[model samples]
Target: MKKFNYQELVDSEQALQKRSIFWDPAIYEEELKQIFNRCWLFLGHESQLPQPGDFIRTYMGEDDVIVVRGKDKVIRAFLNACTHRGNKVCQAEGGNTRSFTCSYHGWSFNTEGELAGVPLEKEIYDNLPRERFGLVPVARLDSYKGLLFGCFSESAPSLIDYLGDIAWYIDVVTDSAQGGLEVVGAPYKTEIPGNWKLPVENAIGDGYHVAWAHAGAMSVVGAIGNGRSDNVLGINANNTGVDQSGAIEIVMNTHTVLTTLDGQSGYALYDHPEPVLAHLERNRPNVIEKLGELRGRQLYGSETHIGVFPNVQIIQGLNFIRIIHPKGPGKFEVWTYAMCERGMPDATKEIIHDHVRQTFGPAGLLEGDDGDFVEAITHSAAGYATRQMQGFLGMGMGRKAPWDGPGEASPGLVNEACQRGFYNQWRRTMEADNAYGVIGQTAPVTPVTAVLKEFRHG
Candidate 1:
């Protein structure tokens, strides 16, 4: 068990994170206690368990948990451990079950986590106290736009507050369709030999990799134009009709953005793009009136991606939310849910699902490229002395300021502001005594109900 100076390992904003944090057993234990045990970890989606008796087994750090829809149709979460002897009660990943029976001793618990039956209880000790032996429930459970989360710390703030400004961005993509979103299928789980934070940092807006790391995939997809030659586009490219607004228009009122491929704002290269365009052409005036010109162009067209911090990552055009769960320091489990509007045509849904499978899933062409980089960085940190050096995140560091952008405050895709914001929030949460401190901070909080209420309502 390699011990680490947590403060020194994390606070060196100028340098690389200490390599020990990835492979050190002692640091992993502390993270299990400080980070995983205290933060609002994404479990699954409400769509996964739409009816009573529906349950899914998940993990917070390494602890097994069961998120279930109770008989009342409300969602609840509990530790998967049996109270009698501390053995894991549920072994399967997810399913519909009326009661969970422990294989070791035949102890059974209902959806509400009440101990329903205990084998040989009367003979064992004149009836052991069943009331005192139910599965231990998690401290807090909540949802945002159908996404579920759980926290072990009793003092943690509401999930809404914890998400802060990121919620606004989430609503844009989530609320694009009329009836909201639904996940297509179970997640595709895999393990990457890397530090958990590396992926999070990457996904939290490491757009710089889109060109070089995924050059082959991008070229194949024809998403890049003249920008293909340079790994990163300079300010010159920003003005050549590829600025954020020209490339993607943010609907400030709605929080969704109108995305275009290489600044081409039309429906040309889509699979069924012709039919969808004809439909839009038939209803152009009304569609334009409702969605506005830019957003209307985005409707049934173009690839738009967004993230709901900590866990959910959605590409609207791709129609999937990749739920990331950190297994330990150097391992992670990714669950991707294919999202689509309820009542979407079967064909449309099928197309969306296939697109997600091709682009982002475990065997996805795009994900394959990024996964290698994530693993290489993790392994490189294995050198004790080399890991002590720094990795530069100062790209566009001092340039970012508060702004009304389509997304959160950022210096676009080329900057590290988003990664910095994620780690900043992460450090705050891990260092706080209780969850309230993490959610209660007085900074540039986002405009979600939880954050607004925490600072203004409270």
Candidate 2:
């Protein structure tokens, strides 16, 4: 069912992709089989369900899933459908419940995904086989920090190995605050008229779009003296972009990181930033003590954007996380979460939640700008002539990053090297024969010590 050359869909060397990928149903089907089925997919944060019997309904490549905390306090996930007659189960988005009862027939399942009861087992069914009727379970479940993920393949690499070098960059944010990060409120959700891949590509490393696409949002943000520029948000005293002398774009086998060695704007866009700044200042010594000045100062509060393969994105400075879920070939849903330090003051948490909605939430100014553009780009591919056209992501092509970080680095934040890395990873998964082929393609993890080079961008 392939309509074009698979090799040309994403050419690593040329840093280009065919426009058909955005509009083709056949390609989207292949993505479901190869990418979503094989890789670990983000579920929700552990903080969302702290006690036994708690559960949330989510998706794993269009497959409805129920992620629950068992009586043993272990997190588990299973297909969100009753075994008998294959009826839908657990319709509520999320809540604390001892068991899920199917609407069609009163079939119930325990938090451990075991069959609990049936409407008429003794009279109607006459000794029905209960052991074989438990919910189908996800093969692998793991956590990185507080984030939960479920993978369908048993043979896929461990979550740590899967994250590769990008893990080190994330450590800067997670390790700095002893209390760790948490999801502040329910995610702001909206549907976008675009390919699922579009926003993932945008969030991961499109530093080039900050100044141009987000001109309106940035203008307002800058007016109050917090001029955010560069890959992540950074304050510029002169109202110029963050200095790039120390910035680096690190592209690994299957992940990308855009770091501008001077991050510091975790909550800069908030109207009252005094408390946030004061909080960060109070933690400065501990951050320096634990991570050292290099990581503590540059990557901690500094703005950094991380793009994990397949479909997860983490953008600090804006201080939020989002997942691009594919609805089909023509549309996808964006689920945005406001993230914050766990031990933060209640007032600060309030600020973080509202700030997230104001900037990157579904109706957020910055996100609104991106939604229209990606939609325009995806819809244009529907035209036969346009679908046959090609696109380029060749900015800063062939340039190596000038840093001692984990992966090979590109020179600046505006470079498209990170975007190229994503496409290349996408191509590898789409071309693979099975889950192992995609999971085994990563390079050996670079030792964290070796990644920390004592070089400044300037």
RMSD of each: 6.7, 7.6
lDDT of 1 by residue, 216-309 (tens): 6655542243233322222222233223332332212112232343312232213343343443355445544654554454333444445444
Where in model 1 is the C-alpha error above 4 Å? 1-7, 11-20, 222-309, 405-408, 440-458
Compared with the true structure, what per-residue lDDT tens digits does model 2 show for residues 20-120? 89999999998887888878898988888889998888888888899999999999999998898888889888889999999998899999988999886
What ranges in model 2 sit over 4 Å off? 1-4, 222-243, 266-268, 440-458
Q: Give the Cα lDDT of each candidate.
A: 0.63, 0.79
Q: Name the best candidate (by lDDT).
A: 2
Scored by TM-score, the top model is 2
